[model samples]
Target: MIENIISALFFLAGISLSLYSVFMRYVMGGSQSWATEIFTMMLVWAIFIGFSTALRDDKHVSIDILYDRVGPGMKKVCELVTLIFGIAFSLFFIWTGIDMVSTAYAQEIRTIDAGFPIWINYLIMPIAGVLLFIRFVEKAYRFFLKKEIPTEKEAGSEWQL
Candidate 1:
């Protein structure tokens, strides 16, 4: 619920800001360079947050062609393999996010439009990366160990693609 709220707020705010940018740029016959920068940041943050929510809800896109044909045990194996991949991807994301944030911070970069430290924008990367990691771990745990996410607890029921 909280995740939904945060993502929705970011998404809505980004769209609103973008629309305002368009109105100000075309209708007012002037440019709002800062609008684009700010909206882009908001949109990016919303997207990253959405990724976490999707994983938690088992709503991420999938190709179930191979999974659909597998037997029960094979299905378990497949799920485990996919879980491993998810874990790997999350770790990689976290590592790269951290690297990006650190590099930007060390260089003392700043955003042209917002005038805030550029690192502030990049900071969301590692933070969202951590959130993604936690979401991945939670889904894996619920499916394989705790089985708390209903379909995850039920054998051969998860529809992840």
Candidate 2:
């Protein structure tokens, strides 16, 4: 819930500011490059945060063509494979994100226009990585240890939430 609020704030601010930027550039015969930079940063934060939300909600994209045809054992196999890949991807994101944030901080980097700390923008990467890692592990526990699986509705979206 909190994550959703934060992400939405960033997203809405980005959209609003970008529109303002456009208005300033064309309508007002001026430019606000700083606004552009800020909005870009905000949108990036929103996107990375929302990425983890999708995973937690089981709304991440899955083909499931083969998975749909498989039996219970095969379905488990597919899920295990997906979870492994998801975990690996999350680890990679975490490592790369840390390296990016550290290097930017060490260099005292700032945005080209807005002058905001570059590391601040990079922070969401590792945060999202951790979120994804935790969610994937939780799914693994539910499926393997608890012997649970998502129902059809949980696995699929039939309508708006």
Candidate 3:
């Protein structure tokens, strides 16, 4: 619940900052490059932060064709397989992204736009990936416990309460 709130706040901050940047761009006749750069940075944070919510709610996109064709038992198996694969993939991303961030930090790289540090942008992929990875683990735990997995709607409602 607290994680959701934090993510929401991060997203709201991103939106607000982006809008302000856009307004400044239009109204000021010659916008500051940092405005756009900072806004872009905030966008990365927003995406990564919001990703956990998406995972928690099962709002991530996937093709349901096979899901529809499979029997109940098969569907469960498929879901388990997919979940395992997802965790592995996310772990790979997390590992690689962390390495990249560390490399960028050591190099002290900066983006061309507004001289923003490169590590900041690269950091999101892993942080978001880790959050998503955690969510996947949570799902797997639920599956093993024989608990009814919450659909996106139910997960969203769980937060409302």
Pairs with steric clashes in candidate 2: none
lDDT by residue (1-161, candidate 3, tens digit) is 76667767767787887778777788877676776677677767877778787778777898998789979999889979988998998899799999999999999999887788899889987988898899889989998898977776776786684
lDDT per residue (tens digit) for residues 1-161 in model 1: 67778989999999999999899988998898988888989888888888887887788999999889989899888878888888888888888888888898899988887777778788777777788888877778877774667543453355445
Task: Give per-candidate clash totals.
Answer: 1, 0, 0
Candidates in order have lDDT scores of 0.82, 0.87, 0.82
Instruction: List TM-score per model, in order.
Output: 0.86, 0.87, 0.84
Error of 2 at 35 (Å): 1.2
Model 1 weakest 10-residue run by lDDT: 151-160
Q: Which ten residues in a row are the worst by lDDT in model 3?
A: 152-161
The per-residue C-alpha lDDT of model 2 at residue 29 equals 97
Cα TM-score of candidate 1: 0.86
Root-mean-square deviation of Cα positions for candidate 1 versus the true structure, in angstroms: 5.5
Predicted structure with the largest lDDT when compared to the true one: 2
In the range 1-161, model 2's lDDT, one tens digit per residue, is 57778999999999999999999999999999899888988999999999877877767787877788889888778878889998999999999999999999999999888889999989988999998898888888887786665554665564437
Compared with the true structure, the alpha-carbon lDDT of candidate 3 equals 0.82
Higher-ranked by lDDT: 1 or 2: 2
